[model samples]
Target: MFELTRYDGRRRIRGSIYLSIGLSLLAAMVIWVYPSFEAEVDLDQLLAAYPEPILQVMGVRTMASLGGFLSFELYTFGWIILLGLYLAYATAGTIADDVDRGRMDVVLAMPISRSRVVGERFAAMAVPIVGANLLPPIVVYVGARLIGHPIGAADVLAVHLLSIPYLFACAGIGLFASVIFDRAAIAQRVALGVTFALFLSESLLTGTDAEAIGAIAPMRYYDPNAVLIDGSYDLVGAGILLAMTVSFLVAAQLWFQRIDIS
Candidate 1:
């Protein structure tokens, strides 16, 4: 069933390795610097000086401990926004790039059904998505211990595990874009724009009368700070993200099946 998935998945291995190394390095750097940052700065006062809205937007509820510090300075920015946008941007190109380069015709000429093609290609996104999530937590745990500010092992694990669905949801947005637009450039741009806009809307609109408007955003479901700092895991949110990812993939498959990919 996943023949094309296996073929396409092999191509992403190197990119996945590179992504894992990059994230691990970033995690090491963030963890290494936390002690120095805590020693030099009055984190509470710094946070107080910042506007409340800005703090809320950044998900910086607390910066008092290593867990809180890493949550605010590392995972919230690096994982939630940066990684999410990256997957969205990368997945945006998967199908549309092939179509734009005249490769889709060759792909369609094969015996595979269009829905299977879409499903398998979208399935291949797991290579990078899972790769990026797998190693960073190990780095984070080891780094925190080396820095003498060891965090809860479960918390670190929970945050990474929960992020998978959130990231797939982000990639799902890109998959939808890839099918809707034959031009890779436009698909990528639109995916990035929509993903980022959802982020902004989720961050800026929380607690306001229009907060519900951001409900569709995957960011609404994933809360790194809540997990890392407070040891709070929202399984319900993860399930919602999983559902959203499935919806996007199914929608893309249906759309691709109906469209003329000429």
Candidate 2:
């Protein structure tokens, strides 16, 4: 049923593996340095010296413990910010690049409809999203054990699982951009900018009068600190993210169906 999805997904697997390995190495490094950093530095004084707004924006609830440190260092910065932006950037090229290269015309000439093409192309983004999420948790978990601050497996699992919907929503934004722009470069830049702006909106608007506006941002729902540090899983937030993902995909499909690709 998803022939194009399979085709594109297979093409992405190697790149995804490389991304996973790189992230795993990063997770290892973060874990490796935590003990030395904690022993050498005064975490409480350091956190106290930081301004309130900066801590709020960084989502640094606590840094005295391993879970808290990883939540702030690895999950929040790496998973939420970096991975979200990467997915949006990668998926931004899906359709627009095809159109720019004259490949969309050939693909459209096949039996598939425009909606299916958009849907399948966006679906293929799971390759990198899933790959990046899957291996890093294992690395983080084992690394934490090696460092003697073993984190909970359930909490680690929850953090990665909850991130999936958030990452997919980011990809959906890229898919929407991919359908709107005919040029791959323009689409990719737009997607990256928009995704980052939404992240900023969510991070900067917290507890402010304009916090309501940040609700639309995917980052508002994905709280790695809640899961990893507090052991609290926000299933409702994940559901909302999944709904947003579907909405973006549907929006892209509808838009792609109306556009004149010729």
Q: Return the TM-score for each candidate structure.
A: 0.97, 0.98
For model 1, which pairs clash? none
For model 1, the stretches where C-alpha displacement exceeds 4 angstroms are none
Q: Whole-model Cα lDDT per candidate?
A: 0.91, 0.91
For all candidates, the clash counts are 0, 0
What's the true lDDT of residue 24 in model 1? Answer: 93
lDDT per residue as tens, model 2, 1-262: 9999999999999999999999899899999999998999988689999999889888898889988898888888898889989999899899999998988999999998999999888889999988998789999989999989999999888888899999999999999999999999999999999999998889899989999999999999999878877788999999999999999999999999999985
Q: TM-score of model 2 relative to the true fold?
A: 0.98
lDDT of 1 at 6: 95
Name the TM-score of candidate 1: 0.97
